[model samples]
Target: MNNNFKMIAKTLFGFEEILAKELRNLGASNVVEGVRNVSFDGDTGFMYKANLCLRTAIKILKPIHSFYVRDEKDLYRKIYDMDWSAYLTADTTFAIDTTVNSENFTHSLYVSQKSKDAIVDKFRDTVGRRPDVDIKFPDVRLNIHIQKNQCNVALDTSGRSLHHRGYRTATNIAPINEVLAAGLLLLSGWDGQCDFLDPMCGSGTFLTEAAMIACKIPANINRKEFAFEKWDDFDEDLFDKIVESSLNKTREFRYKIGGYDKAPSAVRKAQDNISNANLSEYITVERENFFETEKYTEGQLHMVFNPPYGERLNIEMETFYSNIGDTLKQKYPGTDAWLITSNLEALKFVGLRPSRKIKVFNSHLESRLVKYVMYAGSKKAKYNKTIKE
Candidate 1:
């Protein structure tokens, strides 16, 4: 029996490469990359591991079927023919999410409606009952993809976006996303060899993610639940073993991880969230404007943050960015500073050239993750050629 199957891990834009790397590191074979997604071969246990450990994945889906359909009717026929009993019972509720790029399908709702109709119609004919649809919390999540005439149906293994991480309870203005924070850390070549800082740490998202990476803690160790747990095939004992194994691999981190924010409320939120993540022992939060703070550590420091983007670059935002560059150039030496912002105009005000600029999206906003390296005893920063578009 071929227990190994193909799984697709969905990520935000610009994370495909890192997600691919993570999958490969997790012992996934036949790894392949697609737009905003990474596909690989893994067993059921590996699937469980991925849901528990992967930091950059927003969702992990197991593709159950793919077929060619010329019209909506063909879609209904194909779905109606699948053995739904193998995956769901008549009492199991489900929700369908459809993504379409076909000329014939202009309304995604219609596509979802048609698919739901087929699934429920099949159950009614076979079992004399139909499962209810619960959009908020479904027992199973159905995914539909249509590119031209091809359709791929998949089972969403991750219920909510993995960013839920079940940790962050506080948020400041423009706090960065968890998956994005982890992806940004990875993009900045962070490997936990040095101290880390998020000077403008709004809600301490970067701080918590950094600690998890530093200690090799599973990203979702704090997450409440996964969609896979709701599936009929869920194995409680296996999941417990996986959790225990991941926790056993956690290493002690000696490096300093600190966060700072100008606002008192922000500092409190950061502290609360850090405690929620159970990283209070390894991380610290303070209320200090970064402009007034100097390097507290004598060793090399790894800094990552999301400074305010000035609402797309008003004068105040430009000044904020300039102060950031000034503080890094004048006060902080032996630091590798990285940040992400959609405000390109304010970015130029940072003054220091970035060694790397990556194209990524923060929700719908197009953004870039830029890195500036400030050398010890040198006022200027080292950087790669500018990649701004």
Candidate 2:
């Protein structure tokens, strides 16, 4: 029997391409890209692997049903007609998450309530008992998405966002999201070819993520649990084999990854988290002001960081940004520096033209990922003239 089925991996804004590429690399078939999501065909073991290995995916959903509905009554009738027993038992708890973008369903909460009622009513009518709803820790999590009049119901294979990699127990002030950090590193072309640095490293998110990417480590190898583990068809032995296979694929990374933060507390927290991820051997955290630091390595460097967007920092934005540009232009040569920030006005103060600027979102804030290329020697002079204009 062919056990293959279609699945969708949801990702952050501007990460569909990378997520699709990741799925393809993971041996997925029929990979197709969507807005903020990628769809592909995989078996049950592949589903487990995707949950454990995909770095850019926020959630992996296995869509079960899709239909057009005119109103709530139509939705309830359709849901009630389906066989919920395949996914849930009378004793198994479940939760529903609904996202509605249609005139018929204005409130998402109401949609979730109706869907829950339908599922429970179906169970009670057929099996004489209904499963209790456990919102926090459900055996199965369902996703409902309504676009206009079309509704798609899916099983959320990932319980929480995959960003909860179970490695970060401590967070400093304004720590970047793990998924976003990994996506930014991938976007910056960081492939472990050179030394890496996050000058303003907060909580060492970039450092840990960069290390994992460089070493080809499974992204969620540190995750404590996935929703699919609670499924009735979950095969523990198959999952174990998949994990072992992925681990065997891990390659050695020769380049060094380092992080620098002026705050001692941040440095300590970063070190602790890196240890938690078992990556201390590949990464180092130090307490040093980025403005006072210079590039010590003679080889090429790849840097990606997110500086304070001035919401949490009290420093002058223009001077801070200008110093960043000055440090790169004068102190750092043969480096590619990339940073994401929501403060567009402050970015102007950097005084260097970004070689590439990609629009992305850090949660709700509209942000830009800007790249600066600092060439060596004669090329440095030409690059200086290019930025001067």
Best by lDDT: 2
Q: TM-score each candidate.
A: 0.95, 0.97
Compose the digit string of candidate 1's lDDT tens values, residues 147-248: 888999999998898989999988876778899999999989888899999998889999999999999999999999999999988998999999999999
Model 1, global lDDT? 0.90
Model 2: per-residue Cα lDDT at residue 252 = 92
The runs of at least 3 residues in candidate 2 whose Cα sits more than 4 Å from the true structure, single-residue gaps closed, are 378-389
Over 1-389, each residue of candidate 2 has an lDDT whose tens digit, in order, gives: 88899999999999999999999999999999999899999999999999999999999999999998999899999999988888999999999998889988999999999999999999999999999999999999999999999999999999999999989999987889999999999999999889999999989999999999999999999999999999988899999999999999998999889999998999999999999999999998999998899997999999999998987767789889999999988988888999999999999999888999999999989999999988776586877888999
The 0-to-1 C-alpha lDDT of every candidate, in the order given, reads 0.90, 0.94
RMSD per prediction, one decimal?
4.0, 2.7
- Angstrom error of the Cα, residue 31, model 1: value is 0.7
